[model samples]
Target: MSKGKDSPAKDGKRKSKFSDAADSPKKSKKASTSANAAASSSTSKAGSGQATLSVKGSGSSFKQLSKSGAAFASFADYNPAPSTKFSIYRADGLPDETGASTNDTDERLLLAGETDTMAYVGNNFEFGSSSEARGYTGHYMVGVYDPSSSSVTLRAVPTFQVARSIKANSSLSSISSKRTFADYGEMTAARRALGDAFGNRKQKANARNQDRMKVDTANMEVILDDFTGGIQDNLASLPSLDEVLASSTSSRPMPPANLDAKHPAEAYRISDLIPSEIFKSLPIQKLIDNVSDPEALKELLPYSKDFPAWIWSRLVDNLQRSSHLSGGSGGKKHTTFDEDEDEAASVTNAEDVMMMPALGATEDKEDAKTKVRIAYYMSLLWYIQSRPKSVSQRGKLITALKLDGEDANKRIVKAILGTFTETPANSDRAVMSAFHQTKVLAYMCALALHLDNFSVDHDKLARNCNIPPATLRELFRTLGCTASVVGGEKRMVLKTPFTLPQPRKGKAGGRK
Candidate 1:
């Protein structure tokens, strides 16, 4: 052995300097081409996910064009995009040149994907049942031709089976005597007489001899001419890939179908944009009830913009308290005591009550921060409508409510109420219907929560959440609340068996 012989490591794992030098140019060229392709795709705005096809000296082929031109001509490309359009025409099979097809017997056929623009010309011939006396069955040949190419493509393989027997459902005499097609006028000049065969007769023959393709499948030959012809046909008939894709997607929001002019998503978005504080202190449910009429709601909802999320929240709080004070559901009523009971609230109220409240300021500054709590509650509502994930995004929620602009909340509510009352026709009516009950429920929940009345029916509480009545009742039962019929009707009322506040760490804790 020579000392200069290659070592084991060099042979298996290492590239020699000579080899590396030889490969450098190839690697460099590959990298350059890839980078250029990427750059071209980006600058030309080509459809995403489309494969780039290129050819050298291909001349006028899409591949030879610049990226922009390629993209523009994508429809004419032979390859099918995900977004292609096609129309299906029903026919039993190819008709005779005389333009007649018979459907007396059920026929088997294959369904396959095809280019939208290509057309195949097929001819028909007739086959006889026997070497001697049977009528002629039709024969059809489907062939493809391309104007751009000189070659012809013969399509349709004959390996398939033919029905062993075709029952003569029509009168044998009628079939023999018929001069014109049953359905079309061109089927005249009888090729063969079926005559009066009482039953089906088995005739052994191949698919082509029987004038039909056999069971299961058919293969078509696609020649160069056919392929080119197909490409040209597709270019003229099919929409561009971009158009196809755009047509497939919907532009409108998919909220509850019956959303009002202020869509639920839009309303929820607006609520999200507001601060949570506005909803905290106000008796929102009572506010809703007091402004139950559309006109009043319209008047008050826009003013809501002047205050922050906390103020709106406060309104909800106030509304809830008012509902409790007024006695929800119009049952037995009791007079206000204002005695040793409510001592804490009374003392707090006495200290905090003021002749007038300023923006973002309450007589009791700490209580005024109730706005933060208001913002918190509205955020939850927003989540239920806009973000169904059941997680909170405090910043996003607050911002959404604020972005609704001044009085947007009130404006939306007013519009909702108006829609409910008017119940416009068509899509408008649908939108109004969705808001009608939901808005009412929102106010009801605001009232119940603010009053801290766990005794209030949980089912009813959920009803205030603006869900379908049945759904609200189920939720109430799930939460261990009892359902009651109200007003001697099918309408249901939700009530808790009793009120108890589950003690929690927070100071805001109250009756469940």
Candidate 2:
């Protein structure tokens, strides 16, 4: 994003490797001279009390606006002619790296016919003087080129004057890594001690999280949600590729040009996006296994009665999709309701009570893993739909849902249905039960949606959730879910919703 003709190095320290030969000292000489001359003339007028510089536009993007519109407009038209003079010094211009040339070049040069001494200017300067003037000998300048239109302009002297005062013999001493015997040993030792202490604290936290991954499955779910959420937010907020391409039109202001092409928008295409440590940090396999069993998850969420019901509903919706139960992909399976079921049930009530959607007339006879893959694909769709329009709006909605939960669980439950993935399949008892009984469902959805790009830290995830990965794995297995892909090798697709088992297998059988 550097504005210079050449880009900077990785650490933003060295000059850009791609900088053109045009950026060399020779090319800059003419403009530098013009700038210096303009600066000198303005300074002379101001010193003689003939004119005063007026500065404005401080603390804003448009800094130093001119007093008159015409003057400001004409300022853009200001261009200098190329200089013919050459610098007395070598390529770098300065006589020695010590920077002593600034003072010695003019004042102590003891050159003939010299009355007053001058100093070497900034990064840009030209070796030239007016016909009647006498000053510095080591000065230099170069011309500025416009490659796009094949044009060139001389530097304005005013720019040179400003450059001289602000640049030139400025020392890099503060940032130099080069050390000397003059440095205090005790100060260095103290700084290192403090840094070690902070590093140890961080290591301890990492170790603790690593330990938690062994026993805590629920916490892993939460961590996954955080990671997923962060990535999605970043993705949603990033400027599109087209927007970035548009910036390449001009060279005046720099663009964020160094972005890697491989990292373009779709993060799913990259495998490295999911860190190996993420698998170790959470019980991903466990959750994928247990996504089917409604009964087990029912008991897991009872302790947190205050958990928002909508979040739970969203989770169930996601789980259903992940299990391939939301949309029918394979066989037609009939979902029959009781003969006494009411037609006038409220929409919220409709969601609370699982209905057999006419679409899923056939069931997918796939194994647990296939089911899980299907569920994951379905859940991804649901997650995107359930995400809040904006962070602030989502926060406000969550706050309202929480307050509703405290007042009436049913109120919260109704709100939960509103956030469910817009699936066509009817909800079953298992889905409703899972949402009603546990907040884990909702938390998992948030985690997946948030950290879709990154890998989970299983240990941290499990510790925070207070559930073992093994247990989650069992739950999903019971529910008929998998962690793998359900359909195409290129992408995942959710197949169908999970089927709830009645109290007992009766004479009527599963279809009856």
Query: Listing every candidate in turn, what is its Cα RMSD in Å to the true structure after a full C-alpha superposition?
Result: 31.9, 31.1
Candidate with maximal TM-score: 1
TM-score per candidate, in order? 0.21, 0.17
Worst 10 residues of 2 by lDDT: 66-75
Displacement of residue 49 (Cα, Å) in model 2 is 62
Q: lDDT tens digits, residues 99-169, model 2?
A: 54544213111111111222232222343321113252221222233333222222212122211122332
Candidate 1 stretches with Cα past 4 Å from truth are 1-201, 204-211, 215-411, 414-431, 434-447, 450-512
* Candidate 2 TM-score versus the reference: 0.17
Candidate 1: tens digits of C-alpha lDDT, residues 80-123? 43454322222346564556455433132221233344322211
